[model samples]
Target: MIGQFPPIILASKSPRRQELLKLMGIDFTVVLKEVDESYPSGLNPTEIAVYIAEKKAKAFDESIRNEIVITADTIVSLDGQILGKPETADHAFEMLSALSGRRHDVITGVSLLKGHKLYSFYELSEVFFKPLSAEEINYYIAACQPMDKAGAYGIQEWIGMIAVEKIIGSYSNIVGLPTHRLYRELCRITAQ
Candidate 1:
């Protein structure tokens, strides 16, 4: 499947995304570019994700040749409010506290740029968390240091192992990238 695609460039600094791409059996190089992830007002979670992803892809506009550049952004939204990465341990605790015994949406926006053509899409997953105690949340924060992840948590970490009660849609999406959807999209684009 990877052979069908052109040389791939992953324009992200996320280790999870890099690992996921490697696990998908796709050969790619990681290219980091600073991108402002802010979105305009009134955009929903899905739109924000796709917007940031495309914005990141656009950073490579001047450098891209024939290689396919992939970029993605993931966000966790509770109700209608977005919960981005925590700025401090206290903030992480607050975010986790709000997420306790609640359901939230984890949306990942992805973009693929090749030559002059660009495509963007998104995947959303519903995650339910069981009620978490203060001790549990504090412990997870101190031990895991979830300041780098959205929603103050990683679904593959200790918090997820103990707190996640149920999930609907793609698991890999919550981890950062939607591998199946990405693979299908790659196939579709490469076939064209």
Candidate 2:
């Protein structure tokens, strides 16, 4: 039986995350807060993602109680450099263009905060892209709002079908959350 607790809270504005949670039958609320994503320069991709996720969770006012809080941060890394959200259409174009005919890593950091207890984990997925044309990149950038997405692309979008040649890990990780890891972690939190 499900234990009686406050409704789970998701600290994100991503519709994909929200929908994915819904698909898992987890009831949650979208409570987004602005947090500075800047992290130490030396941290690896997973560390950076985890650090930012925890930072976002910590940003929530301390007044909240009981309910579990889930927060996440995702980053796309190529050759050890993190490719974050695009600053402009051209930036998105550049990111995608570079990714063409190459494989990149998408890392997502997930944090589950229940009261004072905090658990954090990260998942990385390798995404391969077929060599794409400049016009194709431009079309994707213009058609999809890449500014809000990491790696300047969305895995569930049209780009995923044509541009993504293969995925070596959890596809959901590229979407923002690793559902398999998240489900297990959330269950552990509930079991505790």
Best by lDDT: 1
What tens digits encode model 1's per-residue C-alpha lDDT throughout 104-179? 9999999999887889999999999999999999999999999999999999999989999999999999999999
Error of 1 at 77 (Å): 0.2
All candidates: TM-score: 0.98, 0.95
1-192: candidate 2 lDDT, tens digit per residue: 543345788999999899988887788888888899899888999999999999998876484687888999999999998898889898888899889999999999998888777799999999999999998988888788779999899999989989888999999889988998998887777877
What is the total number of backbone clashes in candidate 2?
0
Model 1 deviation from native, Cα RMSD in Å: 0.9
Tell me the lDDT of candidate 2. Answer: 0.88
lDDT of 1 at 32: 90
Task: Candidate 2: list runs displaced more than 4 Å.
Answer: 2-6
RMSD to native, candidate 2: 1.5
Q: Which candidate is the best by TM-score?
A: 1
What are the clashing pairs of model 2?
A: none
